[model samples]
Target: MPRAVAPRVRRAPAAAPARPAPPARSRRRLAPRFFRWAVTLTVWGLVAGFVALIFFAWDLPRPEDALAATRRPAITMVAANGALLSTSGDLYGETVRLRDLPPHVPAAFVAIEDRRFRDHMGLDVIGMIRAAVANVTAGRVVQGGSTLTQQLAKNLFLTPERSLRRKVQEALLALWLEARFTKDELLTIYLNRVYLGAGTFGIDAAARLYFGVPARRLTPGQAAVLAGLPKAPSRYNPRVNPSAAVDRAIEVLGAMVETGVLPAAAAMAEAERIHFPPAPSRDAGWFADWVRDGIGDHAPPTSDLLLRTTLDARLQAAVELRLEAMLASQGRAAGVSQGAVVAIEAASGAVRAMAGGRDYRRSPFNRATQARRQPGSAFKPFVFLAAIEAGVRPDDGVADGPINLGGWTPGNGNWRSRGEITVEDAFAHSVNTAAVRLMQRAGGARKVGAVAQRLGLPGPFPRDASIALGTAEVTLLDLVTAYAPFANGGRRVAPFGIAEMRAEGRPIAWLPPGPTPVITADAAEAMRRMMAATVARGTGRAAAVSGLAVAGKTGTTQDNRDAWFIGIAGGLVMGIWLGNDDATPMEGVAGGGLPARLFRDILETHRGRGA
Candidate 1:
């Protein structure tokens, strides 16, 4: 015990090096207090900022004048040189009050956007925190967390940019808005000022754009879709992406059910009955969209506008009626999901009628002018025309059989290998091998592509052997316009939709006729004779009209991806294409099946009833 006590005392005697000098010790102590003071100043600075912001917002714009001078879009379309076809932009329907809206309308916005719309002063602190946590956990920008008032404020008086300044301004404006108006008044302004997709502004325009109905008549599902569009207008637009839009709408509907804004069973029913754009009535659906796209956007006018279009009202109506009826009857039987028809006057190149689909509202996809489809055998005409121009006669004999070009074998429809056949018969029968061989004799795809270009087929024509068979995709408008040479005796005419444009009351512009010579008379006559034979006794027999000389060709792609019938009737060039949007193979469909019948029906109406 004595030895241990001595050892312990000795160890304490060997003292550790005392920390450092007084200066270092005091410096270490000073840091923490300085940090505390700095934090306190930061807190005070934020409080000062909050006070300054409250004073700064005293001069903020009021809510009543928010929309007073706001620009409203108004674009008008006319057919037949000045008959009002449609009015699209700023398409404000009757004024809809929040009190009058189907309760689901306002509720949908609340469910998807701001559940605390009524309770919160403006910004939702709880929702913002929740969204922040969720976004942090998800490692992405998942939720916007912007309340309805915030969105309304941004839309009313701000640009769509993401920055701290913008966020601060949005919050300040939102607070001002809440202070100025009651919940219902704010919702009314929001519903009346929100921008939906497809160039639409306000719930009224959105309802008309998506469902062809008024805001007052919005279904629960439709209202949910409108609510979804505010998040991403172009992304979830039903017209652009139906499946995506539907998915977004389903999320909105779920939000509604969770928020007790809509019943589960009612939501289910509404979900089941979600027909986007709500079965469009007889309106210029796709053509109107096309016209609007052609000319620059027009501002809403104080007076009715007049736009002189190339569309023949009678023909347009008949084309739409027949196109819809055929889809309902013949098209369904033929397993067709979509169809487009473009009729143009051969001499003038004026677009007479355009039936882009069964319903424009259901699908505003303008297949006629927009879609670039493989013409298949329909492209054989260009080959034949090239051959004819290269001094090959319509009666010239060409071998027809299996054609193996660069390891790619092109097959005929019937597979009946006629060793040799007349050029006219080869074209009429749509002999693939013969067309390829003829294309070779006519200097390959280069000459054919040049001929196609001359006939108004704009191209970067592929050099592969498949181009001989029209494997390249081309818009129906281009194809139909190119076929005009065959109808107008070698003159090329571009398809035109606007005859004249008169804004307000004065004429802004007028389109005069422009026809250029593309091919020789002999070549045109020979091709016309051959095409006439196609309608007379070959694959296009179904397209023949009584008492009217019809010259057309039938096209059916490999695996039946596309069916097309393009022809000329009494100097009227028309084309019809039937297919699916996904380019899936059709069942038991040929150019001669539904397309030919539709062509014949339209032609008959034109000749008989003067449509």
Candidate 2:
């Protein structure tokens, strides 16, 4: 009986219905878990899509009345309360309609850029996705997803920068353009708004630039050439690269033929008839360049502004005449090749006359505002001002003999010193030893440095023994700015060129008078008197004009590498410098000579001086 029970138990153990195979609940549990995960992921994706849609929809530029070329660039710099100074940047011709332009002109661009331009709405999503995929595969920007309308929108309202926000804006604008304008009208607007090479804008300007013909007169090959430029303006210029442009023209013609807008035979005929015009004149002066580049603070990149600067046309002409005459008379003999003059209204800090170089066409470097040369003794006015601030009289006594300071030796231009002299005498004669002793007595070189900074010496100013002898480098403009306080009885000056701004026949801005006081009236008057005495009977004597009392200082740098004269007239102050751009020494020329004469001429003739 025990054997039978054991056998039955052993067989029955496996037959417990295999526990019903756990009722197949493993897959059921997994199905619910997978469904929950799917639902959660779908919700998150929808939320993300909603957020993205809102982000792209908000803050779009208003498309109302934007159809006109209101955003066209026009920077015109007028003189201060006077005439036009200059005009720079892109210059556009009149806008043209598709009916006005030859059919091939727009046909060429459309065939090459977008074969289905007429079929798309504001956006061609399929084409854009295809282009995006192609660009991604290429790993560079080989293809552009932007339509012609998109490009027009970018030129009209956006900066030339690439980013996600900009791209979104570009897309929105493209949609606006597509919704508002017909295909032909859009092309017309694009023809007017695009920036072509060599500062030319619009299809009319481009046609004139590349073919010496109007937009309506462009031959098919010329049209193709201009069309190719939207991809790269300067690289495939027909005038610059004839063979390469012809090759690109061949491709454009093939596209035209494929799009059925042109027959291969006709396109080939145009390929042979293409002729490039001569390049237009790109001649510009330093002042024009400055106006173009320096109007950013007011106009900025988004606007096309008309700037009115504080330049006096009469003063500018006089300065040019005097500078040219002086250079022609004495340049070769004195071994001087270049010079600059900067004049500012004493009390107003308005830049009136600026001649940055002898020949701006040859070298566009602006010496008046950009070039930094050693001030030499021209820096002594600030030192003397510091002494005056420290309660030292203009007639105070100081040693003029040789002196040593911390292993550095400094000396005057002549290397010989008058034993003892009054501060006024030392300053007038430009005695280096006396100036150094006075700087030490006025509570060290740092005080002198402070005085220079206070008087508007935009620095890189050095505080050392050599500084007392005018060893620091400074721009002519800064020197003019520093000397303005003495002319205005202690008011600070920041030389400014912009006087007003306008845009599209409307007054947008006017510069207000700025008077920042940094010194006492007594100190400025005392310094002015001392400077007048120097011009009256000292090294700055050449700057003195008949029947006109002026205050001035002469500065001759080491080995005559830099010569400077800063003078203050009735209502204007000016600084003049003569030197080689390479800083090579002249044949013993001194600031008391040519520069002083230049100062005298400027002081006597400047219209703003009102003398």
Candidate 3:
């Protein structure tokens, strides 16, 4: 043991080479350096935050400006008789008060949209975290964290553009809104300004639009349905996707139960009873669409407009019904898949009724105003009119035999033409060869086209002889308008729809100017007499209504691709067209058949009104 101790002492004395001393920097304490760096980072972060706030707040919308923002004007279209036809653009109902609403209505929205709506200042921090976690877990945007106040801010002051800058502005606006109003006030504004589906805005409008009821009368189930619309409105629209809408409403009811807004039993009962009213029949949509499209020409874009349109609600309904019924019953047999109907008041040129297609839900092509198809023999009237102006009378004899002009040979529909016939008789029978000869006698097809253009038909009309036989394509609207002078005693009628327009209960200085004279009364009378012969004893016999004087022409294109009847009856000028969208030939569908019959049916319903 003594030897071991001496050896240890000697080894200690011999001490290992001293280890190198730590650097001066390493010797200093880490706490102060860490504090300095932390302070530096903190100051930079504060500066960045200040710059971000300034940049985002630079263009912040003022509260008053946002409150008084201009939105697309809401158009309320009424028939000539003041019956509600349709609404377009942003449809806002009466400004509803929170105190007046059914408690369940606001509660339903709160439960589904924001559970802590009452507690949150504007942004829901806890909800944002929860939504973040849920979204990450589900790998999609499974939840939304926006409070109702925030939503209101977005709808009021911001575009739907998704960007950090927009979100910051939305947040700032939401804070402003919250600070300026109470919870009830915020909710009231939200309900009055939110967008629902089908071009509706505000809870009241949505209520009336979806359920045909006022906001105060909303049932719990209906309230749930409306509450569900704030998220993915089109996807959950009852009119567009009822099943998805019902499911979403049920989810809303369940949320109400979870949020203590409704008892579980009551919520379940409400879910079971959550059936939507059948979507309001849009029978007048064609007419409404036309009026809406043309409204801009009459009135400047405003916040709210009430249009007293030229549409006759009763006539419009009957026209749509008759057209759809005819297409349903006889369309397949005639190989016809689509049809259009348009009726214009003779004196004012107001479009009283319009059915653009057999089923508007299926196809909305406004064949009456938009589609240009060969009018066929329908163009003969203009030819005859030109001939009459060229010193030819209705009784003048014209050759109806086969004729060759400039390498084009035109023939009658029967393929056997009478050698010679009076101009009136030839017109009634829609003899193609006779029309070409009349065009030649009337200074060629150019003269006939000029006559048509003078009568409100837009044209750089074909200058060839085939134009006399309606080889030129023309819209049913223009053709019908051209025929209006025959009924209105030679006055040219510019087609009009809006009878009056009011902005926010104030009448706008808008009225369609009166028509001007385009043709002589004698010429108009002669043309009427010829067309009267058509309805009385010729191809348009099917269009004759009992006790009503009717004048019209029948048109059948080559291979029967298009069948048309444009007529004047009961002080109205009407046009009908039946054809396939693909321009395929129909099964022997002549204008004298279904088209004339449809005209007769429509005229029968509105017999003495227009007259």
For lDDT, the strongest prediction is 3
Q: Per-prediction count of colliding residue pairs?
A: 2, 0, 0
- 1-611 per-residue lDDT for model 3 (tens digits): 55554344333456688889887777587768999999999999999999999999888888798798777888888778866677877899889998898889999999899989898899999999999999999999998888898899999988899999989999999999889999999999999999998889899889887787889999999999999999999999898899998999999999988988889999888888877665534756777787787766666666589888888777777788788888888978888988988889889889988887876766666878888889888888889899988999999898888788768887676746668899989999988888888888999977888899898888768878889878888888888888998888899988888888888888998767688899899999999999999999999999998887889999999999999999987788999999998999999999999999999988776654462
Give lDDT tens digits, candidate 1, residues 23-142.
877989999999999999999999999897876565556656865754644665667744556766554444689878999999998899999888899999999999999999999989
Q: Which prediction has more favorable TM-score, 2 or 3? A: 3
Per-residue lDDT of 22 in model 2: 52
Question: RMSD per prediction, one decimal?
Answer: 14.7, 15.6, 7.1
Model 2 lDDT per residue over 429-461, tens place: 888878888888778878898889888886766
* TM-score, cand. 1 vs. native: 0.59
TM-score of 3: 0.76
Per-candidate TM equals: 0.59, 0.59, 0.76
Query: Considering only N, C-alpha and C atoms within 3 Å, which residue pairs clash in candidate 2?
Result: none
Error of 2 at 192 (Å): 10
In model 3, where is the ten-residue run with the lowest total lDDT? 3-12
Global CA lDDT computed for model 3: 0.86
